[model samples]
Target: MPRARSSGSPNLACRSATTNCIRCLPQVEWEAPMADFLKLRDRMVDIHLARRGIRDSRVLQAMRTVPRERFVREGLEDFAYEDSALPIEEEQTISQPYIVAAMAEAAEIQSDDRVLEVGAGSGYAAAVLGQLAGEVFAIERHTALGKLARERIAALGYDNVDIRVGDGTRGLADQAPFDAILVAAGGPDVPAALKQQLAVGGHLVIPVGDPGDQKLCKVTRITESRFEEENLGAVMFVPLIGEQGWQEDGRRAASNHLPGASKSQSLPEMIADAAEDLPGFDDPAFGRLFDRFAGRRVVLLGEASHGTGEFYRARAAITRHLITHHNFTIVAVEADWPDAATIDRYVRHRPHRAGTDKPFQRFPTWMWRNTDIQELIHWMRDHNDMVDDMEARAGFYGLDIYNMSGSIGAVLDYLDRVDPDAAKVARERYGCLTPWQSNPATYGRAALSRGYAECEKAVIDQCRDLLRKRLDYAKDDGDAFLDAAQNARLIASAERYYRIMYYGGAESWNLRDTHMFETLQNLLDARGPDAKAIVWAHNSHIGDARVTDMGAARDELNIGQLCRETFGSDAALIGFGTHTGTVAAATDWDGDMQVKRVNPSRADSYERQFHDSGKSRFLLDLSPERHDALRRRLAEPRLERFIGVIYRPDTELQSHYSQAILPEQFDAFVWFDRTQAVTPLGPEHHRGVPETYPFGE
Candidate 1:
């Protein structure tokens, strides 16, 4: 618990006093004054840190002593003490109080220990550490942020703490052999330099792994040659940028796979050497590897991340080629049916349907609403316009099962236009779900808690009724009837999907993939049996999950697995990967979107294997007929990365990589050494913070 400082005492300075000065005084005795802030700090420690298992007394005291408000931006002072990372200068953030406390505690700071902190964003963590240690040396990569942090630390009267502007990865060599070190950002692994700088018996705390997912590890220097490590659980942080770490320009430093110059090429080296060069996507001749999958009925194109520009552009180029040369008619994506239907109509050159102009409007709108996708959509429409055969025009569709309420609305809208009696029946049936309109998971939980009788029955009844009148509805409008029938089916499936997702296990994963595969089949059936379709989805969803450790652990299967099962020789999966660059992602679910810098791919991962190849862009054909060393190397299991619409570069490793047998997962692969984020339509379209009730500060 924290106690108030004595107001106007020699040890304490009052805001209303003669001078506007703030300082932390070292005093043994003080009279109580301004109890409000003192109580608030104590309360924060009690509820946010202590209750959460942060038991270090020194960390608690330092947290209580530091005025968190003084370190934050002017307007954001009110939120400073809250248990969340607040934005600071240069887009850097002052880490949450609990996190700072946890890291400080993990470091096991002694009263006389000399500490070094990498990435001293706002000097907040250094200040806290300074209270526990005798001296603290903090380094920040951004000059402006470092300067500001220095000024703030000086103002707080931390004479022993030093703030320097330089690359944090390259620890201060001149002041080597520090008693303890704390890295505030994530890295692929512990930087060799930082490890060497730790004194014997000293401790080092760092968040290690990819940017999106990381584990807080505590390393103790056992000897000059050995260090013991312990994982302190998962954490998220910015990238550690420097010569020995992620490059500032977002490109990974050239891989050192060629160490010992005389050594022969490794497996990754062989794969890279054999890869075919790929010109820019804008070139008419891009994606020459598609020539190998010429006769494939289903070509599933996968992206490492949703917002990588090269992934989108390359996929679009391949899709365009398939559409023009191979007569591929349908383009199915991993999205909701109702949302993608809007794009379907637009691409088919059909009259712009009311409310169907804009396609994606979900939490991660940037995934499908970016400039690259917009350009692809326009190309589809232009291509459709030039086609003479109506059946030859490519039609877009979504295969995911995430839209229960939206599909219900679409079904009713179709029914209202086609049959008023059917519409009334649907309204009554779907009325049971209207309460949980915003969240289907809540509906599923409620239904599972008591009973699922009425809701399940109603949705099933609605679907059956819609299907029963399909012929009659088609007599007037075939496309409208088909759309309505699909929507009805989607409602029933979505109910089951949501129910299974809440309950947990492989059932939900299987159910969603099964629905997507079934939907693809339905599209082929409707397209007169000669239909060829292309799929666009994350590599996790598009790659054969059976060949990966992720799928084996979860007993999960994805669309790629189903495609291989059904189409066999006729299906081709092409997966894409990138080494590093910028990405558009949110900090948390529904949090404001930011253009985060992507840390380079892990050296042990497949992306590094590609990066080492030295090609900016390349494609590898994995067909057995090629009989190359690359194909043989790719067949071996290796850690592969995958990023979805929600990317947390700070904690990437835990969120992204999985052991994958590359050759078994995909028939072909696309590699980009570096990539850029997809540009959003506007700031308003970026992620927005979720709504939550605020507790008074």
Candidate 2:
């Protein structure tokens, strides 16, 4: 265990006596004067680096020295140094200390290295890198996170670290050479651009694989033309959304054919197998359905999960593939359009710095800060032919059906001007009736009262009163609002309603219907049908044929239900599988190749014991068939080497929704065979196998 420095001693007296004493003191003493919160953090670092076998001394020292408490919300100070990850604004997470240490060690940062990190959440990792390396360049996609990171980094006096708000997959090419790059999120594959930016001997650490099973991987640039790969281990993270990763809207159909099937086989045999297992094929009329786009323009919708490195690479790959193979003329991203001119100028002229007046000065940092969803602006500006005729021919739009909670007030303000009647209803509902006759109910109140009206009036009156607070640019400021409205109009012209697509099945409302969702939905709805769209919500919404089965085609519905209803045939969906073996790097533990069991839910009986100690209420409920399968496999361990279980919450209600069970959602599970473990189970034995069409292509 790491111990705190002694509270008082001659060494401390000498340390405080002169400034030079501190600079010359042993590196360990730099952590002495930090708050107790940092002391706890240092202790955790010791456990992570020493016990966990993180051999990079630079990484360990950096982890120990950086004050994590300074990077989180003030209220969450106590948990600042905890081993578990914590939620930040915009649903992003500041990764746990151990995970950060592991990622940093994996990158193998050298003393004079320059590092580029994607998803600079909280700037904690960047701060750690600042201490370990010569310079750190970090990018955060979310504007709020970018602003917060800038503030925190400056406050900590980390002059060696620089942050910008931008997409990370489009690596900062202006600063082409980076010794190491660490992508904080999970993406489908390594991004080609990032690979190009890596210095000759540099290493790139990222997580690759589908969402279900991600393997940490390090790609090292051996020579200018050669590269080597090493699979590190397993991890779970949010999707990476950018130009190179998998876009949510792009759908690919996988076909599975049986082995040894003769061409002379009867049509009935093919139909029988197709109905039983294969994914339904697209309608032959698909060519006619999209005939309108032959001479006219085409706009593609790209879905991005902006923070994960894996998703970013996937989005980029998908974009390149679409442009190369599919003749996609115009690509509309989930970025802002107003900043397009600036992006175009940068791409063309390639300014080295923004000068003294601009908020960001460094060219590389500026490029990273402005290229995410914001890059859509640049794309539209450069490709004017795609969006020049919004009302008649083409239009660019953002399909961000979900809302960030903080933007509710802004949405309500916009609604107040655009649709006063709806605004009035919202005000009355939120109980914002006040003395000035303003609407407070717009904020979302279960019930309304006269006080709400008074509050609403007061708010509006205060805004009016503060209108001239800044007289010089007041009219120009008003024009800015007009510009924003124009942008909203453009977004509305293409689609009316914002679709609410959910990853988890509809049975769980969790964060989907919260204030943020409502705010975003209303904002998009305010735009009107050019802006209207069908939400591909979870199965819970569309599974109940009675509720969501309306006459509208291509409207709001569950994907699974939509496929079944549209095709009236079985369709295959691809999911990931996990394999266990030895990783490339070794430390204290032997790097052995063995069957490792992987499961979707990390929680097991051990965690349950802490939650419920007495009678062990929760049992791993297995059906009769499943129990029999387990018994048979247990008898012959060698025959049942690896087990894969498909976890469908809708099918296994008793297993997932029992009184003792936790209501977490998981798509599938994989278990590795160990010395004492046995029994392999297939889809039929699992609770929800029949519901999903499996295509292992």
Candidate 3:
């Protein structure tokens, strides 16, 4: 459920590594109190716990009662019930639902009993304990995290659960003799203090072994001087840290214990069996691609990097074929609306609004300002020119929310034309953003760090005003009305977005992707219910994050996974990859553009598997049409590279690579053995970039 963790509730039973780790989970989403979440929670309990042999009725009830999403990272509440653990603050993780259930059951808490949970984490386990026991005491090593856990618990009204910050390995000595003690993190050995703190006849359950490797063990204090230990099962966890556990091991801060791909499976061979040799860009054999996605109304075409020429050319080619023969009318992208609208105007044969900035004028403009993109824009313009009806012509649109200032202007321009009085009111409302128009990020920082007022209400009001006048505006020009309303909505979204980047929640890689997803929805609806669309975005946005670290580990969601839920069989995803390449990118945010050399694919990566398959350029279909054996072979998560507008060769592995199961991450994989950089407008030389860049930004 990677928010396969934007998930509903837990099968939280056996999050593990290997066939072992909580990999390849079936993900779900949340809804009303008596809606999707309750049904999903029951399904999770039945399928991932009870069916797996958890027989404790109390434990099962506790699992079902606690709202795991409340304890999860923000924007990732959707993933609260996934089988896999989700990342939290302090580099810690909320234990997967299965692992928590298993440990809690082993602890054997009873009503009227006092329970202590070592390493409280997100307070998920403690909240569950509060359900079974009369009182629950939770200790966390990280003070800030403990405070957050306390807040989450209190907010959920778990008054029986009390949390504090301290060295948990030492246990709560003054409050000794707890009926049950559950240690969430893995330690080198059982802490003597914890065993001593347990009441006679009580249970102490802890994971014991080397870091990232452990077995859930239940120890029973049978008498004053005797104890019995029993092994539960193999499990993995972050290192237990304290005087009695692993000491200050920063390297173990890694969230997921999922390891590198095992060579035993012979994956490269399996991919070879299903690979389709693709023809060059100009070849008519693109008919193969048409067949692959012929039944799908919306197909997403993704790139390994934003600056690769081959990816751009190929997507442009496939997009061309789709629009020409498959009735595809929309080509949505991972770009800002205000910028893409200029290109949209070009493709739709409408005149670009005077004084509007040309497409991709912002930094890393190379992403859309390249010769390859220009080729597509020119072609789309020509193609639309040949069409009889404007509605039937292919149109380009952007689905990102970063163009705050531009959108404000677009909204104002529209209101001025249709209703001058509303335009004056809009200017007054949008005036709240005047100071930060040059740099919206500073506005968020100022709001958080300097008590600057947020413009959320103003922008939201403007958006509503525009929407309230939708009919009048639409009658003037429905298309323009759609554009204006969307921009207003984007402004409202971006205002909150910029402010929350410094605050907390209402955030994430999720907000941007959510905005993008919603924009796509608006585009499809504006076109019609039966419209066919093609999406062009980075692999991180188009490939299902549920099958990637972005979802399973990072507690993030993307447009790709959203489309899967929204459209099911109606949407298809295809991701591109490269073995080695030269790409145009910036070293840091807003840094100078540079043509960097992309390193060879990591040995454990999906790109490497494709490179080894001996096909320079080919397509591997992983759709339902493929054999189950092939799907099984590629199900194990492996490293996949994602190059954005920024690239860093030295930190490539950590910065660019993310864990992903190829078959589930995408409906198909497109591989290029070697590639070259996109030719940025007015540039043919190398330049120094920035020092640090955001991952997948």
Candidate 4:
């Protein structure tokens, strides 16, 4: 997330003993120096405006005055002066210098104008606007980014800026009547609130349309009653996520308090309404569906390798919620019982620093490290007497220790000792010495070892010892594992484990393979009628693929195909994608590229405006063979305006490649009469030119 500029200094009042001293301090140094900054800034302006045909001077000057280096990450300060977006925390990005300039210029800011900026990332654009406008109000949705932006702005001493934390699409309704609005994020359409908030003659500049294609549109209030819309150029941005934007979709399954009644409403509406529901207390039907295992006996299954932050956060939330608010009696994490016994002792004695060591440093296990988990454990321990009583009444059973593979190993060792009839199966399945080598033959060799035969006898003795120990301390055997419950949820860090385990083999683990869907289906089937499960996965995995080609199935079978085969009509799924602008960067390139921005001629009709001008504008559609060849040929950066094409195998090959072209590879595009290649929306409106047959007009 980009940081915002902070609001200025605190006021001070002082009284002197001998004399009355009253003075206002000099305005804090909020404004960064523009002297040495202007040169590099001007160089960027030339690259974007003069070289790339950015006609808006106000945009250029704003770019010039605002020191972009101040808003960028410290390491990326050198590239700050360049016209390319940089990644910030949370996987968000600060817009490129030219894009900021172009967008700000398109907004048509005036000296006394009040501007509203959506996606207040890094506060770079807001800082620039502070120099151009009277009041700049920037909204950042991400809470952390919002705080960072406020800190940066305060450091720079920008007094004219007001940073607000809120959803951007909704716009600050209380501060209605903005002279101009700039949305940094992309959306499928201009948000209605932004349009309504624009004062007469105000301009709203935003990138609008689908993720694959978007237009930087400048909407100006032409009169009190009408507005003029001009397509500026093509651009890409992150999706604008909020109530008024694209919604996340998925199924919600739990105890039915009227599940059938809520089925008629749209999934988007459900998600929007459910946003207010507390994490643990949401209505079971919808909340449990999205959250998964809301009020159930869950055994969190963790892999040795930790996953991404999102996965960690989700698992943590689920574990916390279950322990705090459910009838969950037992938690069986994958660790050995002896290791868990040590953890239990640590939790009981050193509550604050329980198991705060390697491997056990994850949540619940390392309870002392996390304040929330520590508090929950304290509460549970305090009420242990009552829990023990309940356990006695219910005839509580101690958690069973079954390290599926380790148990198999123990069984194999026993088979070797007894020379049982099923000894071959044990040898083939559980005799491997190397933990990494899971082949059946290795298991057989291990089962045949003399050491394995001895170990099998020892394993049975150990189980008996554990059982006897439990019986000796039998006052509340059920409550013994309660301390471990915090870390014990059957949540796998990698979905691949679930796929491999359920499929009984590792042959179908490819992300691109449709077998992934089959695995999910098997998971659903295994859950059975009494059990309900929610899958937290990418939009491609859960969405109905038949209607939309925007999911993973575009590379395999559509979402609808999988849903029908696996979930049937009983399961509901939603697909979500952020529509941040169009392709600003080349698919294969790392940095940003400067593409020419063209507008429709006033004299030409909407359709005729799609035609080629004398200026260098051409579209090139390449065949698969040609595309691969051209990609290697024009791998270097060059000055040209052309659209690029990638073959979509899921669609009919000819139909998919029919209008596909290498626009970046060509000098200019011409409309081929025979191919009917002119874009109905046109390159001028859609951001790239249409492919033509001949080289020139």
TM-score of 1: 0.61
Write candidate 4's Cα lDDT for 215-263 as tens digits: 6789998777788899875555677776665543312112212234423
Better of 1 and 3 by TM-score: 3
**If ranked by TM-score, best first, what sequence of candidates would result?**
3, 1, 2, 4
What's model 1's overall lDDT?
0.75
> For candidate 2, lDDT tens digit of each residue in 1-697?
1222332211211101111111111223333235565666666666435555678778888888888878876555554654556667787778767678888888888888899988898899899989978989998989999999999999989999999888787779988789999998777678888899999999999876555345678999999989899987655566666765445453211122234634342222222222212111122232232222222222121111112122222233333333333443233323233332123333223222222122122211111232232333333334443434332221232222212111223334544655556456544533332221122113222113222224334434433323323243234443323323433332222111111111111221212222212322333333342332212121222121112211111122333233334323222111111122221111111122122222222221212111222221111211124334322211110100111111122211111111111111101111111112121122333344221111100
Candidates sorted by lDDT, best first? 3, 1, 4, 2
* 1-697: candidate 1 lDDT, tens digit per residue: 1242433222111110101111222232323334655766776787668866799998899999988877887655544544656667887777778779998988889999999999998888899889999989999999998888899999989999999988788899998889999998877678888999999999999987655345688999998999999988656577777776676665444431224535335555576667888977777678555777879999999988777888888899999888888889999997889888877777786655555424566667777777777678778888998987777889889887777777887888888888899899889889878877667767766688867647888999888888787678889876677678888878888888766554544676677778888889888887878889999988888889887753654467888999998899899999999999988766544456678787898755678777877778888888777746556545644567766655655445434555677888888899888889888765453335222100001
Candidate 1 residue runs with Cα over 4 Å from true position: 1-262, 355-357, 450-453, 683-697
lDDT of 3: 0.77
Question: Residue 149 deviation, candidate 4, in Å?
Answer: 1.1
Every model's TM-score: 0.61, 0.35, 0.63, 0.35
Q: How far does residue 558 in candidate 4 sit from its true spot (Å)?
A: 43
